[model samples]
Target: MTAPGRIGIDMVPFTRVRALLGGGLLAGRMLSADERRLLLDGDEPDVPGIAGRLAAKEAVFKLFHATGETVPWQGIEILRAESGAPWVRLSGRAAALARGAGIGSVSVSITHDEPCAVAVALTAPDSEERSAP
Candidate 1:
């Protein structure tokens, strides 16, 4: 039987979401001093990759069920598998939350068509996990 644990699901029709993130990245420099403080307060990567990574980032937050506003979006990175799956690599508070939840692994799947991309994520504990008494 499947064990009980936190589960979260989020999807943005690849087309629209990609555009939102891509645009946000491009305008990073153009962002108002206030806007910059919100999304790009810390180090960030090249603009084009922002869309895919941001999608994965949101997914991780959902799995951890945390809304750490202090956590920078850059803390979550999306690593690709040979089969083209995107995996979550969390850092900072996000990583801490995953560890606290006893999650030993995370699984993610991403799909793209034309100018859009979509992803689904699952977080699970290692076999070492034991149900509470």
Candidate 2:
């Protein structure tokens, strides 16, 4: 079982996100379809939004605590709630890594200021871990 209170945080600059969007490749590689729709469907470039999502993804990846594995960038989805709050959904390698790490759920918070976006992720113990005999 893993220890309690596992947390991860990351920060991303809006300028970097803008550069990635301008490059076009990293944006496609990093963002999920739904995220793309919400962030990229707009007329103007959503630099802060993209930066927040990137920060969120990096933050989520840190929770896995796995070494020698590449971060499954697109496999970590950051979705918005009806209230416009951000949430996390993991798939593929990200989900498997979380399971192996004894993580059940991850809660994320994102905020953006003038130049950068910041995100923090907190993990809950897995059901099996909590219920283990």
Candidate 3:
């Protein structure tokens, strides 16, 4: 059974994402079919700046078995620290749920390759090691 202090991790391959979102890319400045073509022809795939963040949110939901309620998208945002360490941005209802769940901290890792992006999330219980006799 899932516990209050349980931690979960999930991974998504870049190729899969590319296949899914490739067609969605239209001719545009931000991202377009031409860009997709270039990506397909080139060695590296170019994922949008926001793709990683979006995937991270989904990954967080998966890890927690939460439907964006306890940890809504608005609550969890991906950010890059000065050291280039990616982290989450918690706020609003999402932050409240995390606190109530006794979550001391949460960590996320995100990577992007072309069309698809992968993300990992880790949640730690507020307290570890119950009081022992």
Candidate 4:
């Protein structure tokens, strides 16, 4: 059995993220291809959504950091489910670090309101608890 779950939370301001988007470089540096596509494809202005996703990613990084792992900003991907729920998908060194830390699942919740976006991340050990007999 591994350690118990860990939680991380983060918040970002929409105005700050909007300025970053205006510059055109921060989005490319921080978001993955799929994430960029999702943001751009939305009907609403992309600032809030992008800010929420960025907060979610930062929350995930905090989770990893609490576990003593360092992952790049680009290594964490936050995606929306068909039902519009958010989830996390790690890649490259992030995946390896998560595996080594015995973190089998990472769940994220995001919310946005006029000026700010907030996210909470939960990281749990492998699924053995469900399979225990």
65-112: candidate 2 lDDT, tens digit per residue: 988999798999898887788878888999899989878888889999
Model 2: lDDT equals 0.85
Off by over 4 Å in 1: 1-3, 13-50, 67-71, 114-116, 128-133
For residue 67, give model 4's deviation from the true position in Å.
9.0
Model 3 TM-score is 0.55
lDDT of 1 by residue, 69-94 (tens): 54345555565545555555666666
The positional error of residue 11 in candidate 1, measured at the CA in angstroms, is 2.6
As a TM-score, model 1 comes out at 0.56
Where does candidate 2 clash, by residue pair?
none
TM-score of each candidate structure, all chains considered together: 0.56, 0.90, 0.55, 0.83
Error of 1 at 88 (Å): 1.9
Positional deviation of residue 4's Cα in model 2 after best superposition, in angstroms = 1.6
Candidate 3 per-residue C-alpha lDDT over 16-95 given as tens digits, one digit per residue, 9 for 90 to 100: 44555566532222222332453334555544434665567666665545554543655565665666666665656666
In order, candidate lDDTs are: 0.53, 0.85, 0.54, 0.77
Which of the predicted structures, 1 or 2, would earn the higher lDDT when compared with the native? Answer: 2
Who wins the TM-score comparison? 2
- CA deviation > 4 Å runs, candidate 3: 1-47, 67-71, 125-133
Please list the residue runs of candidate 2 whose C-alpha ends up more than 4 Å from where it truly belongs after superposition.
Answer: 1-3, 125-133
